[model samples]
Target: MAHRHDDLAGHDPDADWSLPGWLYTDPEFFEVECARIIRPSWQIVCHESDVAAPGAWRTLAYLGENIVVLRGEDGVVRAFHNVCRHRAMRLVDGDSGCARKLVCPYHAWAYELDGRLTGVPMRRDYPALALEDNGLVPVEVEIWRGFVFVRLEDDGGPSVARMMAPYDHEIAPYRFEDMRRLSDVRCRERQVNWKNVGDNYSDNLHIPVAHDGLTRLFGKSYAIEAAGWVDRMSGQLVDRASDDPWERFYQRHLPPVPHLPAENQRLWLYYKLWPNMAFDIYADQIDFMQWLPLSPTTCLLREMTFALPDERREMKLVRYANWRINRTVNAEDTWLIERVQQGMASSSYAAGPIGRSEVCLRSFAAKVRDRIPEARLHRAPPPGWSRRVRAI
Candidate 1:
């Protein structure tokens, strides 16, 4: 990929913005991201309520590694590398379940809820091996406001609280702990790059253009501002903005949502932590999505949860309506991002400059560049070199 900071030279607001095309399409670069970026980041595994009882377990895959998070007999949640100590076979096959002990199907290597090796098939065969030392390797697990997060790396950075510092005040009032997981939808085998999807969510500039249905119903002309790990994008609902038959019909049926200050109404809040996690908070509910890159071009998007426990049935219905609106918006984004994937493969493309209005996107790209030192070098090793060889 070419490095030309001068591309945005005349565009003062976007002067320093540059994202190499290879970062989105190169398999080598994607591997590096999995190691340096994804592995060390705090990933949401499951909600605490999901594993409320002892022996309850949830299985997940992160950066090519299978993980199992379970509530132990002691009633504390713990995470383990989902592989068995016996023959390196996977211990948990299903997404989630409750079990007295996690038993590997291949060899029946049973482990206690705390990941202690309990029953190894034909235990007499390994007289020299110590069961205590050969138990399932534990991963770092933490719970914040009912959300369970797991860190794979031994030297992972700050806690989830520190990482979410920017939106602490805004999210506190939501009383996330009181909310329950109502529904979840996982879209697997996505054919677009994970970063492309994340980039689309980070900026709401396309909402007015790509999401006509949304903008038409809930006015546009929104403002987008970035503050560390969070970004605020808000618009106003034009009073009696439309008299179209369809708009008027729905307006008469639906109760009015309390309007914010003209400047604050019709807001779309998109909060992202580095690597691949997004927590989008709307007025009625929250949408938590994570981008799991399976390869350079294929990714898995999991709409982990949508909770609105406190809202009335009518309000919940409205929240569901808003969720559908978001679904429409996401479908529009996926259409364009997939097209970009095809365009990225062309030799004619090299790089692109961020738009002045895309301040959040520019900030995201800057963070990516900052964490990815390889972006500074003309030729560098693949992204996962550190993980593959255990040397940076």
Candidate 2:
């Protein structure tokens, strides 16, 4: 278990330690992570249903890329740079909408739904500009179980389907391909490194101590385990009544999801993928939480909720109750992570020992250090470290 960058690597292989605090606060460290870990990773962009028709499209602003995902006339979904091919003007505005053509607001340049340049304000003004050659620049795209995923820059690694194969059988029953969007992607900005949010998601030990509603619902049944690329957590709801009205109502009215097994009906499962994607699966709905880094100290959290079509009054009630309950959980996590960010930034702090049972957090930290070996340093490297040194 000796790592190439750290002299202390020879310590027991099972030893779990949190990443150094400098890694969280250093701007140089963030740049290294973006190049080594973020750029080449696959990102879940949108569900197919979000752009179900040829004219439907959605945009994602991540790291520094302005990407638009859309369905074409031939029924194929594609991704392209959101910039106009003419003069680099943004081709789309806002989060999502249906458009017959992607027209640039700056110069009136237009593109077909599939990104083929179709119209320019002055057609004969530039005869040298070839329409076919000047189509929008495409980004890599893959659809997994009807969910659209794109890589900002490809690194010839495994596809999302390949990486997710370990849990394919378990997730098959949910039939993500058949589910439809319950809401648009909700954006939440926070003053913390992206890893802080990710580390919080993989953390299980904090729940009983910090989330009162979750403690009342799941009690001591929560569990977490890690694989090389994903972490799984599950908790079965307690039969005992909860004092919280939302939790009680949810438990009482959670109608039998006929498609799921008996055990699954009462279970809440969460899966965190390598780098930045996480799925919160309930029998009633699936919620995705994806965190993307903006700077050394800021990140954006994008969330989307999906569910199978059901119009039953009880089912609707259950869905609303579920939102109310999880809203509390998310707020609790925000407070905890912001505090972690502030604490990690303090001169008094270095690194702390991770509790023995925090396996998921340990795995995530190990992966980070593995991806960017410099993350093993107790202090931030010299400025210009990213450009002056090669990590991998």
Candidate 3:
């Protein structure tokens, strides 16, 4: 049977159609998504504090590309391929650390923090090699509100600043630049496509039924709006007691966060930067999460929370409450999304209609389709088909 991909061409932004089932289950389509939609896009890796000091480095494997974010002696942050030029051995084995220079573990080839090939075991062994050209491949790096973002390919799309301009004034209240890391990075792998997680994140209709903790906190008052490529969700925190005892106690005794303006005192603001990253801002702290596709049917979820340096007892209680409620919400979401993945793989499944409340999800799918037309396929394209496409 023919697929619905024909509808992707010049589709209306408000159309109710969802992406086809094959996009989530096909391995070939997944790779196309990585190259077309993810690789060329700016992806948030970690906060600037991750590589705050000279010589500090953070490494990540993203869509088959191994990347290292490092701070050089000049106090500038740079990103590079994690492979050594010679023999292509991985230069770093750990997730993060500090070192004067990066040394290849296999052949002892070394490079400066800025990615210059400064040492090769025996200096005179390679007379034909050009040291400058042999340095690690550089990736585009940008820092916005203390979040470090790296683009694997130079697609010349909008810079991080341009992408975030609409929300700059709104986010200034958080003083993200001054905020320090408040929790160790938490990473969990899930048996679902990354897009499945993104679909759940942009869907507000499931909040009441899927996320009980969030429903208790927001009282069905959450509102989501999309501007340019940024989607913002704001919910007014309720003052009433909750059905759960701890949740009730949390609402009644929520500690004061004076750093946030009085109007923002009881508001939870969530911002989704298209394709992969999401920032969640609450009264006392801000956290960001990213979904990395490990395979066609698996993804890695990474999250980190940040806050102003506050050591008061009341603030500590508030942080603890936030953590407790957040865990409950995440668990609920995980359960729902995992089932959605299973459903996508079913033979009876078909593209469904988007709801009025799912405009953000529609917009996300639109952006993906606009960039990679192959993603609109309702069934997997034939083998070696992507190589024949004129454009992704």
Candidate 4:
């Protein structure tokens, strides 16, 4: 059904919309978001322990940028653009590896683990070539609770630690720093806008209607709220049996985690940072993902799971059961997102109303409009609109 733009956006008390439909479908708006929102936002690359040893490295590719998170000889974790300064050739390939020095495969230019230029082949041929000033360009890095986060450009926003300070004390007992990686990093592509993924994750209104297993586990205890820069969500697993085999297995086999507080032993937490960093903290494991914008209507999902070492047989079974349960939730979400994306593309649809009490959705919309006011428009601004605004 068709809805008037102004009435949906302002006049009708029944309708409060998030980003307009065109915003999700516009290539120009996507470009602006990548430059204005994604570059400055912190992205989780890998856990610090992933690059624990000297010279260990992991590569992250996101929204046209490639990054390398390396541990230097001095045992410090640092991040830098993945391109060689000599010819912009990629130095490291694949997900992760160890190297004594970053040597370019193209020209044999070498850099120290700390990103200082060390060797260049045929040094005398280019007498004016200054190795001292040509190391890999650095990216800002932050390690919070064992996660390594990097941003292409410093936006002067709060560090990851400061941004999540509200929940630090409560989550401290989880001891994430001691957790070990449990699975290899995985990635997949989705044919929907990146914001669709975030919006679905933070929207608790869909749980009872969308995820029955989650409702079975958490009952009515699943809660959501917006906390400044983060959208916080959690559900306390009810101490009861489930008819679903997977959920039942988890409910029966999941043992008490001695390290976590009694209340958190069965709690599952979800936190979405300002842009697209999502932390899914569970009693069995913590799984984090970066929903990166790949194109106007497609996004990349990269994630890995981590947890404390537990060799017990049932604990292993519990983790597997948990995976299966969430796997279904993800598949269901994919179906829902594709339907919405298709519906929004229709000639008639303009925007959908977001309720006022929907704190997470409201918070997300406000943040987008705050950074990119063009998002407030009912349609995509004309070409050169940004320049016109700048001139004014």
Task: Report, for every candidate in turn, its global Cα lDDT versus the true structure.
Answer: 0.71, 0.86, 0.82, 0.86
For TM-score, the strongest prediction is 4
lDDT of 2 at 69: 94
Candidate 2 on 131-197: residue-level lDDT in tens?
8899999999999998999898877767888878878998989989999999888999999999999
lDDT of 4 by residue, 163-258 (tens): 899789987988889988998998999999999889888887788898899999998888777777888888888878999999999988898899
List residue ranges in candidate 3 displaced over 4 A: 1-14, 381-383, 390-392
Residue 350 lDDT, candidate 1, scale 0-100: 63
What TM-score should be assigned to candidate 4? Answer: 0.95
Model 3 gets an lDDT of 0.82
Deviation of model 1 at 117, angstroms: 1.2
Look at candidate 1 and tell me the lDDT of residue 218: 63
Q: Write the per-residue lDDT of candidate 1 for residues 93-193, one digit (tens) a residue.
A: 87888999988999888899998888876889988879999889999987887898998884546788876786677667666776677775475667888
Q: Which 10-residue span in candidate 3 carries the lowest summed lDDT? A: 1-10
Which residue pairs overlap in candidate 3's backbone? none
Q: Any runs in candidate 4 off by more than 4 Å, and if so which?
A: 1-15
Ranking by lDDT: 2, 4, 3, 1
Give, for candidate 1, the lowest lDDT window spanning 10 residues.
1-10
Go through the candidates in order and give the C-alpha RMSD of each one to the true structure: 5.3, 3.9, 4.3, 4.2
- Which segments of model 2 are wrong by more than 4 Å? 1-15, 121-124, 390-392
How many backbone collisions does model 2 have?
A: 0
TM-score of each: 0.84, 0.93, 0.93, 0.95
